[model samples]
Target: MTLTLTVSDDVRALAPGFTHVAIEAHGLVNGPSNEAGSALLDDAARRLAARLDGRAPHEDPHEDPHMAAWRQVYTAFGSKPSRTRNSAEALAKRALSDAGLPRINLLVDLYNAVSVAHLIPVGGEDIDRIDGGMRLIRATGREDFVTVSGGEETVEHPDAGEVVWCDDAGVTCRRWNWRQGPRTRLTEKTTSGVFLLESLAPMPVAEVTAAAAELAGLLADFSPGADIAVRAPESSA
Candidate 1:
């Protein structure tokens, strides 16, 4: 692995437009960092959810409870927010200042905070047993874009050119805004979690690393009681 990263051999098969990211870390929770982050998300969640009320639907084919609010906003915008940078930022501004849910936890809220504030989809899965090495590529209908779990809700046309984060398991995650990853998700009974700050474009390795540090720092400052580890994609020899 290069620079502490352990990349899978599937990199060679990735589509030309996709960039891969992977991170692994461990840390202690309940400190100042965890507390502040939790609060920030709490506050943001309340405001965001309120704004998304009546607008965010429970079933958008790309259903995610944590992202129901933001997804509602995306649906309002027709689900095509230009795929450019700052899309998250626009959504966050609308969500926090406008109005909806006052009942989400801090972890989920903070994820929304970063996602909307930065215009990137941030999502995670339960810390379950993930089967194999993951790869990021395009879904040539071979791997269609399924939004909600149980293969129920899926997008009819997922911007065909858009890159998707998939594993051998399936269309397990994505980058447009709300991400889904087997290892990086945080859920109930979760004491440890990992966060990935994916790039809008092929960011320099330095910048990507820097974003990871800042995100971890933000968590430490806000959610002062949760353990968070931030890292970069695994490097190869």
Candidate 2:
């Protein structure tokens, strides 16, 4: 079955430069992090360091044009960008930190690598767990957002007017990539998934496509014979 993804008109108006590409894959082989996965993360950190070009690790990542654009969008939706940073910015911080990025699993580590290396927000969802088509919209603060807190299952609601990714079930990601709900997150047992790579203006759409392409390549290498397909970048504006 084909999965549908859409951006609401209101959200497009809020961020006129939003563009995203989705990669759908099946027959994936996900497992614990290994030497290969660790090497990929290491290379991604080096690439990010080179891109920063002498910027102090302690410096604000939002100073970069791409991150700044995301921050502006967050602010437009009543979110504090500093307190709730986009996934890419959050991973970039860890990449630059002495502690380094945490290795989740092979699939997660792979996408996190692309996110840090290209400085774009990338997320993956287990397709089998999704109830219906995914939509990006401004929430009314009443949607169910099931998440984990303190190792126990919990339910939360997004702030009114906040941007979120949802499906027939409820919110999949809240705060526009800041946090992903646990229900649809890809796990080690996941064999099919959809990956979304997002970007904003000052960062060309071609670059976002390039990042998606790189991710697709890595997925192919790591999950050989997997059926992987990438959708063209779609502009939300």
Candidate 3:
């Protein structure tokens, strides 16, 4: 089956400059981080630390035009910018601060590293767990959102008109680049997955394409035999 990732017409009208690069890779051997994976994470952490100097992401997430554009989309959907930060902003803040970044698994750590380094929202989901194709669209306030809260799995629903990533099952991510649902989250057991590199205007398509390429290359090196395909808004696999 062919997996597709797309933004809806309404989403386009809301943020015409918004674009994303989707990458699908199979044959991943999800496990502990390898030498190459650790190197990539270390490199990204160092780069992010240098950029931080002493500033916090919360100081002015809106300062980054790309992040500001995402905030606009969140606000348009009734979410508060202060409360809901995009994934990249949140990760950068943590990586730069004393808290440091969390070393999840091989795949999550790699993407998180890239996200902080590039200052863009990147999300990875297990494609095998997805019910159908993925999409970015405004919610109707009734889509089921399966999430884990306080260590227990529960079902929640997205607010009406909230921007979300969804599949045939329901909402996969809420508040645009905010939290992801537990149903399709990437874990150590994930062998086939999709990665999303989301960006906005002022962030050139070439840069985003490069980020996607870097991610694919890293995966190729860490997970030998993985079949990776990348697709941007203007380019196909």
Best by lDDT: 2
Judging by TM-score against the true structure, name the best candidate. Answer: 2
TM-score of 1: 0.51
- Model 2, poorest ten-residue lDDT window? 54-63
Which wins on TM-score, candidate 2 or candidate 3?
2
Better of 2 and 3 by lDDT: 2
Q: What would the per-residue lDDT of candidate 3 be over residues 152-193, giving only the tens digit for each residue?
A: 989999888888999999999998889998889898899999
Q: Sorted by lDDT, highest first, which candidate order results?
A: 2, 3, 1
lDDT of 1: 0.43
Per-residue CA lDDT of model 2 for 1-237, tens digit only, reads: 779999999999999999999999999999999999999999999899888896777566778999999999999999999999999999999888888999999999999999999999999999999999999999999999999999999999999999999999999999999999989998999999999999999899999999999999999999999999999899966
**CA lDDT of 85 in candidate 1?**
21
Candidate 3 at residue 164, lDDT? 93
List the candidates ranked by TM-score, beginning with the highest.
Answer: 2, 3, 1
Predictions: Cα RMSD each: 9.4, 0.8, 2.7
Model 3 accuracy (lDDT, Cα): 0.82
